[model samples]
Target: MQITVNKTGGFAGVNQRLGPVETSSLDSGVADQVRRIVTESDFFHLPEDLQGAPVYDGFHYAVQVLDGTAEHTVILAGMSDDPVVARLHELIHLLDEAVGFQWI
Candidate 1:
């Protein structure tokens, strides 16, 4: 599986992007965790447009996931306590750690 995260609309209005990273290249444990989440998540079935917190000057995330021939892209404008957001947050965190990027 491959994952990519693009963050925009933060306080500084900066644009940041991370990966087309392959889970196979990650540490065994981290990769496993990511794969498990994707497997158990409704990620693949989510709407392409997703609303999150909607905070002013907050961040927006464009998270794209690809597995085999399946691909999905979800964009969150702001953040919320929604389970999907939480799951994406966790996934982003793992990706952040994997690539040495910070999301907050």
Candidate 2:
């Protein structure tokens, strides 16, 4: 499995890309964490876009996951009322932290 995260459109207009990292090579615990988030967030079942109207200073995230021949992508805003959106954001944030990136 592989996962990639691209973050853009924050207050500073920062754009960052992390991973395309291979989950199987990651520490078992971290890989498990990623798997748990993917399952709990129902990431593969989500729409291709979750973006709403742009909010000034709000961030946007695009996440992609690949497992075997299957692939899924989800884009979401910085804040949302949808539980899946919130969970995906949390998952990405946790991943960023795990990879040593400062949280936004």
Candidate 3:
């Protein structure tokens, strides 16, 4: 699994990261566990909106999910008190890889 996180536009102590978890690389059980942990979650509870919300220090978070890949961008004018928000974004990407909907 390749995971990467970049910290920007936030308070000095805030942290952010992202990664690509290869489902083919994980053991079936382990992969299943990861899948269970990550899924389509609600961002409404977060301190921002999907289209426009402050994430950190005059920034916002834009999340993009794809098969075997997830990308995130922190928009300025954002502030995040909770650290897990970033982790959750990465997890959501993994979930999409694990068992996300697809059109074929």
User: Which candidate gets the maximum TM-score versus the true structure?
Assistant: 1
The sequence of per-residue lDDT tens digits that candidate 1 reaches over residues 1-104 is 99988988867886888887899999999999898777777789988888864789887789999999999999887757677777877888898899854444
In candidate 1, the residue pairs with backbone N, CA or C atoms under 3 Å apart (3 or more residues apart, or in different chains) clash, namely: 52-79, 53-78, 53-79, 53-80
Q: Is candidate 1 or candidate 3 better by TM-score?
A: 1
Q: After superposition, how far is residue 95 of candidate 1 from its true place, in Å?
A: 0.5
After superposition of all CA atoms, the RMSD between model 3 and the true structure is: 9.8
Q: Give the least accurate 10-residue stretch of model 2, judged by summed lDDT.
A: 95-104
For model 2 the TM-score comes to 0.84
Position 100, candidate 2: lDDT? 46
- The list of candidate 3 runs beyond 4 A from truth reads 1-7, 12-17, 27-30, 37-62, 68-104
TM-score of each: 0.89, 0.84, 0.32
In candidate 1 the C-alpha lDDT for residue 48 amounts to 88
Error of 1 at 43 (Å): 1.2
The C-alpha lDDT values of all candidates are 0.84, 0.80, 0.42
Query: How many residue pairs of model 3 clash at the backbone?
Result: 18
